[model samples]
Target: MDRHDELAARFEARRGRLRAIAHRMLGSARDADDAVQEAWLRLSRAGGAGIGNLTAWLTTVVSRVCLDMLRARTAHPEEPYGDDLPERAAGAGPEEEAVLADSVGLALLVVLETPSPAERVAVVLHDLFGVPFDRVAAITDRSLPAAKKLASRARHKVRGTPAVPAAEQDRHREVVEAFLAAARGGDLDALLGLLAEDVVRRADPATLPPGVAAELRGARAVAEGTVLLRERARFAAPALVDGRVGLVVAPRGQLRYVLRVTVEGDRVTAYEVVAGPARLRGLKLAVLDVPAADWAPDAPEGSPSSW
Candidate 1:
């Protein structure tokens, strides 16, 4: 095969890994696809010229493309989040399923989004992909030490808000399930019992189109806020968010809320309800029916899950 054909084959071999990296960096499958396409274009134009590691070179190209896109996106924000998982047959291979599961996990992606582009690139390279700091620095266009520092900072930020113990996370799910049941049943007392005194709930202000209440604070305020959605909002499914139990609620088919229940000891300390399609889109959740069986809590930890 010609050098160009050889290069194309090499690029194809790394497609799955490249897509995963880009998806984690860009937080959108569509954007990741675009970035990868752009990377391929760059590679094709370069021909057989001077690239040492094809995978590393392609990764850098995709990273740069994604960074530019992210910067532009900040100037013109789009819908915040949505499902980006590619549909697959039920008989897909275990490796494909694992990749799909990790790629679409809302909590990990959300945490990655908190960092700057450089920090994200550094962390994903060094931590996730096992790239050394010197290599990461070259890819991210930073000095070796600077790249290490960026990765360190990203690690600190993420580890500081580590996922709650699996057991606590499971208990949180139970609390949320109970609350949802009570809400659907219109049992105000049971619903209130599940909430903390200083609970805070916020809807995506962008969705309201001006002059609408965006934030609701305090237990009483939060309880009253639910009243507005009493008949409209419906719970579709539940997931373990950042090692915490959480539920997805849709109002009028727009995916209005992601309710993350916070627990401290035996009592619920906070119920953070993130609503509105704009914000809910950040969580790429698979819409599934919530099972009735009680999911056993994973092992307990001292800290709660970061919502």
Candidate 2:
């Protein structure tokens, strides 16, 4: 085979391994693919003859690509893509690592998200992937001991104790349930008690009534507005939105909007009512449990299932 084709073959041979690494570094399978492709582009441009270890060279390239992506992500929080959502995946991609990581449940993933990019790299590489701290330090541009410290701190955040992941998910679930109950009952005090004083609620323009503001700030405003939606909550059901506890509002089993939330400690810091068709379709949504009343009997010809 010609030189280009030979290098391509070598890359394909390591595709799965590279994908697994990228997935751990970047939580999204789609983003992992992007990082992998970027690695290939650079490899094609640079060639492989000069590299002594293709696998290690590619790993470092992909890791650096992922690090840049993470840094950019922090600079520009993913804009709610009501307008710019990427095309849908043609089929399942390299989601197994992402799924298995999630299978430990979202508490771990949420905790992982709190770590800085360098800390995430150190923790995921050294702790999860069994990489040596020296290499991890090379990837993160830290001293070996500094890289070890990053992983140590992240480990504490993720698992104050080994049992924390499971316990934290349960606590988060309860908080969601309580918030829903309060919203449903139009209990102002209960709603206030659940929201952080700095809680912010943002709604997609498509979800708002004409002229209603898209963003609402402060716990009091959020609570008051939530209580006003008591009637709407009648059609809401608990679900997991983007691997986190959230709610979907389906009137007669047809999804009208989704409430995606960000919780810190016991209170909600931010939430968005995503109703635009494009944005809703892009979310990784799943019904948490089959609520009997999710699709009211005798009420619909188009219910979304037992969710």
In order of appearance, the predictions have TM-scores of 0.56, 0.51
Task: Give the alpha carbon lDDT tens digit for every residue of 89-194 in model 1.
Answer: 4565534433333232223344444567678777765565556677778777889889999999876655423266656655665776676665555566776787
lDDT of 2: 0.66
lDDT of 2 by residue, 186-296 (tens): 889998988999999998875555666788899999998787656555445556677677776643113567788777789888889888767776776653532334212
The C-alpha stretches of model 2 lying farther than 4 A from their native spots are 79-88, 92-109, 160-307
lDDT of 1: 0.58
Query: Where does candidate 1 have its weakest 10-residue lDDT segment?
Result: 298-307
Per-model lDDT: 0.58, 0.66
**Top model number, lDDT:** 2
Error of 1 at 307 (Å): 36
